[model samples]
Target: MVIHGREPDWSYVARSVVKVLTVTAALLLTLTVGERALEVFVDVGDRTAQVYGTAARIANPDKRLSHGYTHSGRLPVTTFTMRGEPRRAGPSDGTTEYKIVEGLFGTVQAPLLDGPSGSLADAIDSVEAKPGDGRARATLDGLPPTLVGVGVVEFAHKMTTEQLVAFGRRHKICGGDDVAYIYEPSFYDDSSDPSSLNAIVWNRDMTREDDWAEFAYQCETEPERALAEFRRWVGLLDENDDLEEFELAYGSLKGAADEGVTYGLVFDRWKLADLRKLLDDPDVGTIHLADVAFDLDTWTG
Candidate 1:
């Protein structure tokens, strides 16, 4: 119908149509790939968050109760709820930040202490010792002996796992005859001077001598499992490469993994008087008083 234009240039029109079709197909393919990539990235992040809570709980076995993940602008924030306190950690403006507390008094932050390596006395002081009568009294004046307090009792020297278990059995809490509720064991070796190995938290709430004996058996027969569990949590230490403490912890563990956990034991519920009696034992080192649950019925697991 266009008699003036050289036969309507049919080839040019066909080439133009082909070029448009090719471009449209390429765009659709690119968009599909981009969407899938985005989904994969999000999925990975979600899984990481879930496992992070597990890792955090393991790393701070004595403290952290639970954890979750949220976002601040484009950065990710990990929130951990410990003993009714909420703490958030994340990267902010190229610097790591820990949101411990915010109130009218400004942010109150309790930074992690530097791990110490030195004499036993120096290492003992590294952990903040709660205020209590060094011998038999509770930290508070009105506190009763029935109120169970969690305490950490470090050993004076490395003991065989058998010896350690025997010690717990012998110096059992509650008149020195009842079964002791040992929650975890700190594997420390004096050979690994400067830093001690981390503690290995066992499954809690099983209050029986048989259960403890079984754990001792595992420590003696299956050292590999204990070491693996220790490494799993130690591997997830603060991402800032502040690994000297953890390294020392691991070294102490590995150095004496075969011998026994020499550092101490985390006794779940002990009367202050009972814990004090432990101080009299020649094998016992120092005791650090920790959480105090007032209600006798309160189950500390």
Candidate 2:
């Protein structure tokens, strides 16, 4: 075709051919890209639907998930650097290891349940450890003494590819896609002292001290579920000020200005079997647990 006021010359024809080829190439590229994009979109949608047990894609997928509480600026507890000590001469005396444990935690008990439970109290009293009873308490070492409040510091070891895929499938969080096969999505830091607000989820394979990952998979998948659980806990809170103070300390510690003192909770080996039993339950997904040094002492101070 002739240009505006241009002659129909060989140069014009050549330029027209180039322009036509360029336009045709661009259109083909656009269609190809669009078709490939549609295929990817359908694939992702179908897989996510399968994860959620839905027959179709739901509207507004992004808003529902609690993706790492982007506003919270939370960091991993495992990120805390442990002080390295020279190995002891006598078969590597795990003394320093235990001492560090003592400084951070008095005794590690897998509480039958989280919180100031009579069960936890009884667990403290009934532990089979020889001399760690009344006299033992968490020392002020290894932890920053001036910490104003406590937030949960969790050390979540990685999960196996199979387990992660299964968890994602069961929970409908991710479809075990390679990109989403990460521990970050499941990690949660409940600075809320109650620790009930943020619960611990045991890894199916509890190799690392049995408390592998405290990811809020439930919250990530169903954020409202956490709020509902929080409400239920609030309703259970007694009228006693002491109880309120303790829980309030837990829930609000995250808002503290500086790094507050955070302690640890260790699960005694004896209780692991029972915890595993609970984990096997179809209804139970994750348990509520914390690393904070609540009152582990059963004796008079």
Candidate 3:
């Protein structure tokens, strides 16, 4: 009876074991393939949405107008690591490693002007060089030959006259070629307090004595004037109330020097959107804002 048990159906037992193993292996392979495909699809969809969404937002005029407000918010941080090794024959020695951390909401895009011609420097130069005779001929003489040859001042004059003609030709202000508008955001300090809204004008046409005299006059006579006045006359002010004392900073480069001063401001996402809105307004005319730094990393770097 024991010998009969050992000889029965050995082939059937082998086939059953093989079938079970094949089924289990096929199921595991299918799951693995499905998971990989899902991961790829999700990644692609997310990237496409981010790129397209940002591009669309920037292009929309309603979203791009400038609003005067200080940004005060925190953003999510992303870290990146880079590693590099020098060539064997190179004079430099070792591997280079670096890390970069970026904040998302710290970046803001503000509109400067409606068109490329609304450059702040050009506006200032035009105002400073224009003769009292009400002709831009003197301004043209002071400009570089290249600029004069290209008829930048002539074009500016023509454009100014045309704008005046459209704005009822009579009772229209004519000398706007010399005026420049600038918007700067910075952390407020007691020394250079944002609350004490004031305009800093460098009247190149004014003699040094006159310029100093005018500065003194403004410092004393209108020492504590509102930012609105400053904005209207000189075209700039640190006037937003949402900004706190330590949240804003600013500085400017002297001439064409590479180095410039920088200031910090509290980050605000909503205010940044408002700034874009101001720039997009058609009635604002040729407004210009300069020294805007949206990329915190670049500014800090």
Candidate 4:
């Protein structure tokens, strides 16, 4: 121990100092590395923003086109609102000239022909009779009055259906009656693939009734048979995936039963294009899409 007191080895002291310096240098290097990594992340985020901006600009060359159509000054959404009620065709006067006021999707302003004022039977008569000329003939010849009513209702329903289809197409969402799912375009490799439209059918129905006037008159009268027919149509479409995106609807006169007067369906908005397409397919037949004036404001809400 006394020998150790004689100038403790300076070499050991020098080695300890070297060790501390080495550790300090390594710690400094680590801090520098961490700072560099953070800087890289920031740079990446900025670059991504720039790329997105450029892509958006390129995709929408016209500045005005970015917002798309101004649907009644609002974005389009799914909603149903009565455009207008069928006009009151006065009491059935046999000589009254009943005109097809609004075609299929039209609102009866005042009775066009002499028929019931507020009955489905009158609606049938009005629809059956020639527009303006007063010859009692179905708009689509050979179809019975009941069948014609169903077609009218189908037309109105199809408007809502087609809108849904268009929306699904735009968003690449698979639409059915029940569940619908949409995938972000960013997640897709080939965005054009129809499979990207992932959606499931929930339920659908369309119906028209000869007793619609009775049902209309007695609010409690359930149109079970008509509704069943509609459900059957929906079921058929559901089973066939190809028809899932197709339209469904109906139309009826306000006074079909009473006066034999013609008034357009209460809610008609079916499109002709869709009807044509449906008719072209062998699976479906001579269904007519009635025209109705839709409340643009409600549609866009």
- On TM-score, the leading prediction is 1
How do the residues 140-230 of candidate 2 rate in per-residue lDDT, one tens digit apiece? 2333332221111111233333433344356443211111111121112477333332112112111111124453434233323322333
Q: Which is the better candidate, 1 or 3, if ranked by TM-score?
A: 1
* Model 2 superposed RMSD (Cα): 22.7
RMSD of 1: 14.0
lDDT per residue (tens digit) for residues 183-259 in model 1: 23434557756434444332221112122354333322232333344444445433332223222333433344334
Q: Which model scores highest in lDDT?
A: 1
Model 3 residue 28 lDDT score = 86
lDDT of 3 at 29: 84
Candidate 3 regions off by >4 Å? 1-122, 130-133, 136-224, 227-249, 253-301
Error of 3 at 279 (Å): 31
Quote model 4's TM-score: 0.18
Per-candidate Cα lDDT values, in order, are 0.40, 0.25, 0.26, 0.25
- Model 1 / residue 193 / CA error / Å: 14
Per-residue CA lDDT of candidate 3, range 1-301, in tens? 4555467697998899899999999988878756644533433223222221222221211112111112222423333232333211112345444322322322222232111222323332233234324233333343332210111111122222223234222322122212212222111237753443211221112111121344332221121121223323222212321112112222221110112111111111111222333223332222222222243333457
Deviation in angstroms for 20 in model 3? 51
Clashes of each: 2, 11, 35, 43
**Candidate 1 weakest ten by summed lDDT:** 84-93
